[model samples]
Target: MSIGNVSAVLVHGAWADGSSWSKVVERLKAHGINAVAAPLPLTSLHDDVAALNRTLERIEGPVVLAGHAYAGAVIGSTRADSVKALVYVAALAPAEGETVGDVFYRGEAHPLAPKLSPDQHGLIWLPEEAFAAAFAQNATAQELTVLGAVQRPISVSCIGEPVERPLWTDRPSWFLSAEQDRMISPDTQHFMAQRMNARVHSHQVDHTPIVTAPDVVTDVIVEAVQAVSTR
Candidate 1:
């Protein structure tokens, strides 16, 4: 199975946009694979999924959808037939009838994890300090600066809604568990991966490994792409 015709749609998580997958996009391209960073509005779960589907619609063939952090729930909610496999990168995977918050808070929080609250606009912004302290502690200082500058606050409604049966149950799935993630506990990642029966690839990375450890992130995504291609 030649993967030359396949595409990889990389989705970003809350508090970030499409550019978050820049490193992974470049890495995937180097492997002779086509990858696109799907921009998510961070407005609400519905809006994010719509945005992701829109991107998926533009691609010409089968897709290996990869989502990071909060985008995990977004990818899982998608019902697109073109999406053949799912790759969860330190992401949250809420089951049918479960809200994103339910899975995100499944276990104890990391001491360094920021205390988040919605503002008057009902949007939750990751504190600037959290970019380095927790979100991506392993990222370079320059990377942290860019991450903070381009962050998009997520609306409270995004995490409150329950998802339908996730696509993970219908397709082959892979998970990259960020072992040292400060935002999402490693235990929670493992729990979700096991629940979905996804192939787990655990690594000692931070919450935002797409920026801090692009290689690790791309490795899992490429693995999913290959699996989809062979199928």
Candidate 2:
């Protein structure tokens, strides 16, 4: 199921670094797919998009840009012509002229979802306990520990600012609606997926499925990549 010349560029969401995609990366590699996790600064939307572009610029040929959680916004911001498809894994999809927070907080959040606020430094950090309670309750204790330890605080500015026209409108897209996601509600996922007319693959997975359910995450990504290759 290898797609020749097409590679994958994975972008992690807030509170997570590139390492969050480690499991998926290994699986993609085993399938002979060139996959790399693009590191986001979590500084601001502009900065995060810049970092994503930096990664895309380095990769040759077509790419399947897959984003997790908050990174859905980052992936859609890229104007790179090489991007042939977009994949959202329990990700947020903010429409044109809308801020990430707009869609993120559209519906009611899960009862267990942590109450988040920026600290004095204006950086929003997920509570450590939220890693297990909300982010990936299905994840093992060790997985939760590592997720919290390597967490990166996202800037308040990241979600507040309105995004430019999203690239998803111009490309084929696949959405993984994590039915059991606590961070982003399933209703919200269905709303975004339907609005975008994306091919939806709903699964009973947690928010951080890239860690808790790597195979499920990779399955959607590979489907998008294969779609792009055939095009």
Candidate 3:
């Protein structure tokens, strides 16, 4: 439990690659904090968890493993004990035996998720309109254009796959709720935060808080680092 010097590993969510954390990485580095963004496969939970675990394996010292959106479930199951804490940024943070799909179905459906249907490859992607409105609601015209072009298709199977274990149960956790999130409601985020007994922070931003409010996100992450060090 005593991980000497702590670092951070950032895991991004669906439709996004690791570049989503570019500003966050820069800010953390400016403070001399070691951080790396883990690029998830996003194709399947199994593959994504493997990628996360591999990244965790390479880090030296204690780590605060942070995840956004879908990567929440990924880090939960990756079994990286070097991860002394977790920070969920508008992320799923599901309990053991619960799927991300189950969480969504139980909550009121968002207006912008799009009517999804899987192809022969079993992938599900949000329509361009929904992506623009829900995922990047706070983005400028240029950022929204870039997001549209590079978005990756997520595997439908990943949504319903239950996490075997939830890291939050064993680790100190922080949750940043995007109060203006269009894809996942603010109420649903509150429910998850309460369920996990997390130290919760709120922002008047979209689902992609890392982009819309990097400084606020960085503040919460730095607080988590301080908490772990104190403990």
Candidate 4:
């Protein structure tokens, strides 16, 4: 399959939506790579994976599945024959016996990281200020405003749920580790990526590189597209 023949389907993490990949989608299209950002309910892992699989169903075969933050488990569990590659962008990939929360709270929390707690509604929201302080520390003031305004809260149940065997275990995979990330520890990212033996790309970006560093994020996805095509 050629670059134009394969598509990249992006899955946004918790507290985010499909629009999070807007810049990367634009860049992929410019390179003649079809792109789609799967809308996740963030209600539960099953719901998110089902939603991603639906988006995967729409795209043709030879697709590269990309995820950020919490969506990593979502993308990994939605493994299907249509997918030829996996891309983890500062994302998590919990083992079969592990829950999202298990790997999420694995390392010591960053001092600048905000404390997370679910509201009465059972949704965990990123405090508005945390957008600039932790989530996207490198984002501009304007970008921070947009990120905070359009934020979506994730269900507490989402992380509590355990994951099945992830596709990264066997598929061609790429991982982009955010070195300056405060959300998910950079150590955790490196550990997961290395455990999967994925081709790794480390950067001095924050948690949400798809927004703050689209070029870095897009380049890796582009590389994944070309890589699977050769295989």
**Which 10 residues in a row give candidate 2 its minimum summed lDDT?**
1-10
TM-score of each: 0.98, 0.98, 0.94, 0.98
TM-score of 3: 0.94
In candidate 3, how many Å is residue 211 off?
1.0
Q: Write the per-residue lDDT of candidate 4 for residues 141-197, one digit (tens) a residue.
A: 988888998899999989999888888887989999999999999999999998999
**Which has the better lDDT: candidate 1, or candidate 2?**
2
Candidate 3 local lDDT, 1-231, one digit each (tens): 232367989998888888889889988877667889998877778899998989888988788888888888887887877888889899897788889887666677677756777778988777778756788788888777777787788898789788887888989899999998877778888999898899999889899988878998888888888778777
lDDT of 1 by residue, 1-231 (tens): 677777999999999998999999999999889999999888889999999999988998899999999999999999999999999999999999999999988899989999999999999999989998999999888998899999999999999999999999999999999999999999999999999999999999899999989999888888888887888
**Model 3 spans with C-alpha error above 4 angstroms:** 1-4
Per-residue lDDT of candidate 2, residues 183-218 (tens digit): 999999999999999999999899989999999988
Score candidate 1 by TM-score against the native: 0.98
Task: Work out candidate 2's RMSD over C-alphas.
Answer: 1.1
lDDT for position 72 in model 4: 90
